[model samples]
Target chain A: MPSVKFIEHNGTEHVVDGTNGDSLMMIATSNLVPGIDADCGGECSCATCHVLVDASWVDKLAPATETEESMLDLNPDRESNSRLSCQIPMSDELDGIVINLPEFQY
Target chain B: MTNIVIIGGGQAAGQAVASLRQEGFEGKIDLIGEEPSLPYQRPPLSKAYLSGALEASKLLVRPEKFYQDRDVATHLGSPVKHISPQERTVTVGETEFSYDKLLIATGGRPRKLTLPGSDLSGIHYLRTLQDVDNIRAHMATAKNLCIVGGGYIGLEVASVAVTLGVTVNVLEMESRILQRVTTPFMSDFYHQLHTERGVHIHTETTCQGFRGQSGKVSHVLCGNQEIEADLVIVGIGIIPNIELAETAGLACDNGILVDDHCKTSDDNIFAAGDCTNHPNALLNRRLRLESVPNAMDQARTAATNMLGGDKTYATVPWFWSDQYDLKLQMLGFSQDADAAVLRGDPGTRQFAQFYLSEGKIIAVDAVNSPKEFMVAKQLHGVAVSPEDLANLDVDLKSLVPST
Candidate 1:
């Protein structure tokens, strides 16, 4: 059972169990995480399910696809580590992954 | 001690609960819905659910425990029969509940075409999970499927039906497919896409009546031409659910009239989603949009205003549709654009059409081009050189004037 830590903008943290093969967006949304609004329901169309991965854990995660990069590019607030959570799936090697919720899900 | 009542069970109602709790509203929340299932996304009903690729449980907008933990008293499978604005009470089924504030997120229903012999048993409208389930059951036996209206819903269903080895015939009353929502280029693009994939498209064909055998629809009579259809699905359009507001004496026109703040005629009541014709500050028009993004954004704004916050929902409207291997994403809507610019060749299966008015990007239609769609949302209403937009060498990011 892998786990993911979601840190809100206000410094509050939520550690929830993540099942293997489910996207990070599904895990955060299923657990009622407040900040990540997966409005498109895992469709890469809407970039609302945005999260900035922890700098230490950034390289450990799968790289964002070209489509995801294009979607993330237009955002004025997008950081270098910013990725749509829906594009990342959970895995055993990525256990205890730490991700930060952006101030707004634009 | 505060009581907030939300009427509707779609994404708007579901998101309203999340928004309310996140905004720190420590009060009683009641959500009354006509559907038995919790709030779910309707987009998948046409694509995945119809093709048996996705299950029924996956359609929910949020998990069930999310609402239960927040203590949202959801009255599923029951409609709000009456709303008394003066008393701030809504009658759900047999129970009467008083509210300090109320939200009418009652979305909309499919607009049915009433022609001769339309009461046939095989006729259906793609709106709910039950509708898709029933249609899927028919698809198992249906050989010739006829889809009325060549809009997004109709074309999406056609793609699925054709993929399932069922012969699909799309009948559109308009001169071209997707005429109501898109420009000629994109409509023609979809027309070619569907035809190339083995779909029979009948444009400018008006269905006059339906004829059935054994009480099930078997044929569609279009003027002098008759279309033989073993199964029929109508995707014409939708009618907003504004009867409650109208009965309660709220202002109504094309839809329940609301301001950018999602406030109705009565300050105590707010309306969101497809049911309300809200004014968009960016578009500067009062329009009723039937997109999931619009519904969620408006619901959040209404929740904030209901909790005494002064937030407004004026975000640029955007929508997406999937059919076969193509994904169409659109931002903004204007059919009366004086200038339409094309970026990339449509024959390449990846292109974008920009609709400009007064030299500003008013609307855009992007097919299989996510990069253009993403840039279009940020540059909505911004004036750009049409030459720069048509030039492929210049990066679209550069065209987006640096703020």
Candidate 2:
């Protein structure tokens, strides 16, 4: 199984195993990691499951679609590496992914 | 050690436990719910869960392990019978539990039709997981499905049932479908969309009663005409579960009245979710919204305030409804708007209805057009003319202050 690291805004870290079929939000949430709200349950509608990806691993992930971008644009704290974790599918390519969670979801 | 007790088993209950733990409360947290399972999201029940595209486990906001890992004791399958604010105690079943602070997240129940033959076996509602399971079971061999009240639940169920080869008849008491929440243009859009997909929408039709055979619903009688239906589903609206709070002497109107901080009449008790009629700081009015965003946001606020932090919930209300392939996203309420503009063409199945009050944008209904929705979200206090709104050629991102 691939592993993913979630770092909270306070610098607390939680490393969890990610399965191939589950999304990053599911992994973070199932591990009881704080900060990923997943309000819409991986529907790509609510951008609450936001994660700021590390700069080095930004291009390793798929680019966000227009719908996701539109959802993220509603967030005032969205950053350049901002992505809805629910939209990111877990795969072997994302084994050592580092994710930083925003301080507040809403 | 301090103890915190949360009532109800919906999104707010689950989020409260998570929020309390995240805030480092370290108190004895107990989440007692009427349902047998963990706190789950109800949004997908009408859409993906009804269509069997989403499973029951996926609806949970957090799994059981999270609650256990956080030392949050979950007592499921029992409803809180009484709340004694004087002692800060809640009674569930035969056991009485005391609390230092309490959260009433008791959601709402589907409003049921009290007409004749309403006790039939095949009649169903789509509120909980078991309700959908029952509806799906009835749809297995059932052909004609009569849906009462053409609201979000009724229409979303109609779209799913019709697509699954079930003949659907939607009976709305109003002159048009979704009359309460949307304009005629949006209603017409949905009417056309559902009609194209083989759904029989009967507007201005009232369901009189259900005629059944062998204690099973066979037809829905509407005034003089009776429509044959093997199964009947009612989606008129939801009555907030405020009875629990009312009996406990909390102020109740259409919903449990709460302040902007989610604080109820009692200082030791707070409320959130669909159960609370809360004041919106942004809108400058009180509203009882049945929305996931409100439930989640208010849960955070209530949790922070529970921990002695000053937090106020002033989020501009937003809601979404998924029917067929169209995702209807609405920001704020458009009822107070005097002028409305149709941004983009509805023929392309992508446009937004911008509603303005006093020549300033107040609310919007975006259909498959999320860019305009994002722009509309930031236009709460900004003043803009209707021409600026209708002009889609200009990038909507440029109209607002860039984040």
Candidate 3:
């Protein structure tokens, strides 16, 4: 199982083991994380599974495609490190990665 | 005074700007949108907009002058490329505009198929005026249309296509149409209704690719079946625009995560509409809804918070889709409902299916029954005895809140 760390807006950190091929959004949702809604079920249709990749892990994550990029543009707090967790499939390479949860999702 | 800037030309952004002004905020308002025309309603784009019953000009939520009259600096056709939260500014091409508060209502884009022959001349995805124009032109000469998805957009477009003497074929990858959003009973009701109307629906069908002639789509290849088509409308779904949010340093979840107050990680910024994910009080969980009601409701909540007013948005989720002569209205989340009670005849296509969980009304999907829908919306989350619901003379409205 791959593992990832989730850091909340208030600086709380949670480390969880993730299933392979499961999206970061699914990991957070399955864990009942307060954030990470994943409303559109990882279809990239909804931005509910947005997360900010830790600066050090930014290069480790894949770049967003046109569909993901267009969806991110609709987000209010778009930033350089923002990535929709649903679009980021979990793998061994993403182990030990850290993500910051937004304060609110809607 | 706070300087608030909103991006996107849609109902959500327009409502946010107007709500801000209505709330007595004397802040500088700048509405930057990529659409060359004024903000308009998109639901009609797949329905009335294609039927010629609604003119493009009338689709505008408010006239062009309405923004100027309301003291909003409107920037039509301008798309924001970057955001500097540290500097409280957004850069659109060569122009850099500053803001104390920002709202992103960039909305969504229709998903386009990338299969072979997808770039063919007759293939299209409905998202904007340009797509609508192409579809309208094709409608004039086309006789058969193959819709790739059986969701709201596909069904609504089929409704219009059938009315205009066009033969329609809907392909659904799932065994039943609307399996993701609706109950099995509701799906059966709609399936029967469409079948009776001479519409051919193929379930459990997977599209292999498209066959084209002279750069124009001529057939949709699904398994061993070749569906002849003059036009193909793909309504797979939409992706929310979150690139700008990700480019900035804000925290993002499935959407720009906001608390009950609609504030993102940054206190100075907010997100609403289809680009946000917030907790649904009624569902007792977090969700991202794409309906117009959710968008408008969240925009108001974001606007209020931007003006120093803290208000938590907690409304029951509801959605309505019109197809042919049937109007399907659904309320609450039915994903977990264990039992569904039918209130009318599905054969007639005029009924309501109430989804129940632990003897509580969790959701309701009504077809051509506005009265039942009205009652169901009020009965959401309420503990109702199944016996009382089955009784035809019982007035459910009497049990709801006064307000």
Q: What share of the true interface contacts does candidate 1 keep?
A: 0.68
| Regions of candidate 2 where Cα sits further than 4 Å from its true position | A9-12, A30-35, A73-80, A102-106
lDDT of 3 by residue, B1-403 (tens): 5699998887788778768876788879999999887777777788778999868865665556556767889998998999888999999999998998998887777777888888888889998877898899999999889999998889899889988989999999999998888877677777887887878999999887999888888999999999999899998988878889888988877777778888888888888888887887767789877787788778889999898898999988877787887767777878878877777777777777888899889888877665566566656778887766666576554455553
Off by over 4 Å in 1: A30-32, B401-403
lDDT of 3: 0.80
Question: lDDT winner among the candidates?
Answer: 1
Error of 2 at B42 (Å): 0.5
Identify the CAPRI category of the predicted complex in candidate 3. incorrect
- Per-residue lDDT of model 2, residues B40-82, tens digit only: 8898898999899988877888777788878899999988889
Error of 1 at B376 (Å): 1.2
For all candidates, the clash counts are 0, 0, 41
Error of 3 at B21 (Å): 0.7
State what share of the real interface contacts each candidate retains.
0.68, 0.54, 0.00
Candidate DockQ values, in order, are 0.63, 0.55, 0.01
Instruction: Tell me the interface RMSD of every candidate, in Å.
Output: 2.2, 2.5, 18.6
The predictions' CA RMSDs to the true structure, in order, are: 1.8, 1.8, 19.7
lDDT of 3 at B163: 86
Q: lDDT by residue for model 1 over B95-180, one digit each (tens)? A: 99999999999999999988998999999999988899899999999999999999999999999999999999999999999998
| Ordered list by lDDT, greatest first | 1, 2, 3
Candidates ranked by DockQ, best first?
1, 2, 3
Residue B358 shift from truth in candidate 2, angstroms: 1.9
